[model samples]
Target: MKDPKRADFRGPLVDRRALLVAGLAPLAFPGPARAEPSPAPFPFGVACGDPTSDGFVIWTRLALDPLAADGLGGLSAPTTVRWEIAADEAFRHIVLTGEATALSDNAHAVKIEVQGLAAGRPWWYRFMALGHRSAVGRAATAPDAGAATESLKLVAASCSHWETGYFSAYRHMAASDADLTLLLGDYIYEYSYVGERAAGRPRRHDRAADVVDLAGYRNRYGLYKTDPDLQALHAARPCVVTWDDHEVENDYGGLLSQDVAEDPGFPARRQAAYQAFFEHMPIRRASLSDPWRLYRRLAWGDLARIHVLDGRQYRSPAACATATSRRGSVVGDDCLERLQPERSMLGLTQEDWLYQGLGGPSARWTIIAQDLLAASIRQKGRNGVVGHWTDGWDGYPATRDRLLSAIRNSPAQNPVLLGGDIHSFWTTDLKADFADPESATVATEFVTGSITADPPPYAPFAEMLPENPHVKYFESRAHGFMSIAMTPDRMLTDYRAISDRRDPRATVSTLRTFAVESGRAGAVAA
Candidate 1:
């Protein structure tokens, strides 16, 4: 969450002048200093995401001096920009061209949601601002409505901790020809420590303790973008993203922080975090808001509908009374009580929208892209039985159960859930009650491990896997991502793991495969 508290580490600082300079760096520069312009914005390259049949959002940030330790360049003026979408890599024919403005107030970033395009078509685009050209990004429109499609593919990944490892998983994703990339949060971890910065790098802005202001948040993202592998992935294809706990504060809720003594100002902090997140991410203007509401639907023809959920914004507090508790049941009754039928992760209005949308669509697959596991997971510790991390969907059992019931009754062909946050891979049969060994599986879930965080070591949990028959697979010793394939008849998911997270050149391997057939919610080993 914030690098687990350590005495050696100092908190972030709050300075208005420093923040203003960092936020205004792009506008201060006049034009490309050289005759031959750079091919693209070096570190914070170009990308696209949240696509629909008619339109999609394009993204790029101006980084005149990315290596600046404070992550703040000296540009303070607004820059007029131009972009083009072409049919080929060589830009033989430019299909779409328009003007965009990058302002200091928004950290010199631009998100253009272009419309009036054909479905299921491949397109290439790039950006130009202050004489600088961004890398050419490749993106595709969604398939035609109700058209019979053979297959759809996507790369799923999460948790890219800068200190833990390199983003080799992104390299693998770039190699695969995926329709889109699904990022399940932890995009940036708010941490500051000695011996953690790379060689020749200076310490950037600190958060006083954790991310509280816009500059702290911006600096964190800047640090993450410095990774070449991540930049490669962004340059390669579009990505669909959702935030997890670490994006704001670990185990935070509406107005509560994990530490009682600390004043988190969660709602205000959440607002700032949301603003920073929108300014930096490749999200559509429609999805942008003051508090950044991220629940929405993405339709791929009539073959599938993806329901993306925001878990941290409206969730209840953790179940365990104290953060240091070792009790098996981390979810406390106080937390569970608020998860009544009316309580919502996407809020009441969004829940109704999802339910109505599901009933209207008859897709081959209905997938929920969420931040944490939806399936019930009960672990047996040395003392007794324990439930899931209080921060996950398991913390609100009632809400999860109701959602599952809705899926079961809906007309959707197959219901599947994709989750991240837990730094270990898991495949579970989403049953009404996992405690009952014979509970019927109502949906299938695939939980991808962190992209870089160390997995919880294989301990007694390894020996207890057999006791939980509903869990078909489990791996707690690797850091990587998941690759998923969807068809009319079956949904196939491969758990891809890296040889070693610590190794920058680690090779990725497919550790296991699971499939869910049409009309069936449970997963079977492949």
Candidate 2:
């Protein structure tokens, strides 16, 4: 007798004997598998990340009921999930097939690091479990290390607050012709509201209270993953992800909490947040074992070398912070602690690792992917005094100087910095000395605007622009992302903005375009 819970799927099927003959046997999973075929097995959809020349990591979570209060995705026992990767969209040519166990402990999430595949091309993938199949996703492997390549297209986005507006930018990003995506930070917010939803807010978070425990964080991620546009964007392009403050808590630094300086439960809360983040994200197993291993490097042939940095975990506390509020604060030039040389943002260890190789000799373009803006920005604090925000690179001047010196002294060519987290778009010239306009420009920095988060008031931000001559362009009224394309000769970037973030069916347009030529230090209008 057939199991009534299992539904019939007429999709393509692979022969078990043929797979064994090709030495592509599925991995052995123990225990009797409990099937959840009713509410669809893959409710959160599919995602792939951390692409290498040979393979990439593909992920999916089996959710019978995604919004269950237990944060287990309505699963009580272990289940076996089968995955396949094909060279074409149709399943006619299967390259690899494998099976994995989805245990309830980790929310039934499966992350498989596929290997031994061809490089520099796209591959189609899908997941199967108990007569149900997931949506087909597209992923590609990077070109061989040091291999000559022509061009690479990348999309950079950040700060999508679900309660504020719709994720229409992700829908447009999914339709873009890009090879890779970088989700810089603030993927999910930690705040949870009560009573009726706020005015001008499109939606509310899933959990009823703030996320301080493991279950709360898990449910929050579940809610964000349910967004169809976000799922589509993940399925379309292989992503490289890193987190900012909201992934754990707002403006948290090192082992200190932002709200209360000496919160006793902060360590456990941070651990739970890290565990939930690893379980949901498509990162490798190395990140799970070593929590601080988020900083790494990836090579896309000889064209570019992407150096991803983690600036949150091991940093010194913000300078000039009060005893009660330990994260970030605006401090004027008179604050002596803000200019101390001992304060570091990336920690001494990561700073050493980042400065070691600097940039290799192979890649023509060196790309620095990080959380916050690296360039210095001065804004009016109070009483007409000029101050710097301590949450970003400006707070750690010594570390920033060391980083800039490393880039200037290394063999790295045509270095470009990509950043987010200010909720505004900025194109600035990274100078050796921001105090002097005639100082040498070291590199060009492009800061992507938020996807849905509210921006700071533009009038004040614009009023201080004259004080910052290195700032080529600054716009705070738009909500969009940056589309970057790079070749051996030059890199072109387009600031793509949406008409309205409140409307789900918003239209997208290019607000501006800029280019950085080979061996150039600043960006120019393209």
Q: What is the C-alpha lDDT of each candidate?
A: 0.72, 0.84
Off by over 4 Å in 1: 1-42, 67-72, 193-209, 287-291, 320-346, 380-385
Total backbone clashes of model 2?
Answer: 0
Candidate 1 — number of clashing residue pairs? 11
TM-score of each: 0.86, 0.92
* Weakest lDDT window of 10 consecutive positions for candidate 1: 13-22
Q: How many clashes in each candidate?
A: 11, 0
Residue 55's C-alpha lDDT in candidate 1?
59
| lDDT by residue for model 1 (196-304), tens | 3444332233342556767677767866776778878877777888898777777666556665555436567766777778887877654435347777788887678
- In lDDT terms, which candidate is top? 2
After superposing candidate 2, which stretches have Cα over 4 Å from the reference?
1-39, 193-197, 287-289, 359-361, 382-385
